[model samples]
Target: MRAFAAAAIGLTAAVALVLTVTAIGPPQDGTSPEPLLTTVPGPKK
Candidate 1:
């Protein structure tokens, strides 16, 4: 009985997470104007 209850709770939480992400939708384009990392300079010869 305890195992069954735990399984049910886990399933409910998973479904809730999926729904929340779906409602939020995908991210918009150009959200970050600048790149995350800058170019590294070449090593001196």
Candidate 2:
């Protein structure tokens, strides 16, 4: 019974970690903070 309980807890933790990563998406390398920058200012219509 103890072994079975430990396995269940491990499985639950693994699943939780996977779900958390998926929801946040995979890590990105060399990603820029700003891809586009506008310098011009236009009058409001």
Candidate 3:
């Protein structure tokens, strides 16, 4: 019973770590604070 509980806890922690890492995603090719929002601004209509 203790082993089962430990396995469950380890699995949960592993899944959470994977999700957190993926959620943050890879770093962009820039040094900006917010890379996605730091692209060249588009021309106004």
Local accuracy of candidate 3 as per-residue lDDT tens digits, 1-45: 999999999999999999999999887775677547667889999
Q: Candidates' lDDT values, in order?
A: 0.90, 0.89, 0.90
lDDT preference between candidates 1 and 2, better one:
1
When sorted by TM-score, best at the front, the candidate numbers are 1, 3, 2
Return the clash pairs for model 3, or none: none
What's model 1's overall lDDT?
0.90
Residue by residue across 13-37, what tens digits does model 2's lDDT show? 9999999999999677767788675
Q: Estimate the TM-score for candidate 1.
A: 0.62
Backbone clashes, each candidate: 0, 0, 0
Best-matching candidate per TM-score: 1
Give candidate 3's error at residue 12 in angstroms: 0.0
How does candidate 3 score on lDDT? 0.90
lDDT of 2 at 42: 78
Those runs of model 3 whose alpha carbons end farther than 4 Å from true positions after fitting are 30-45
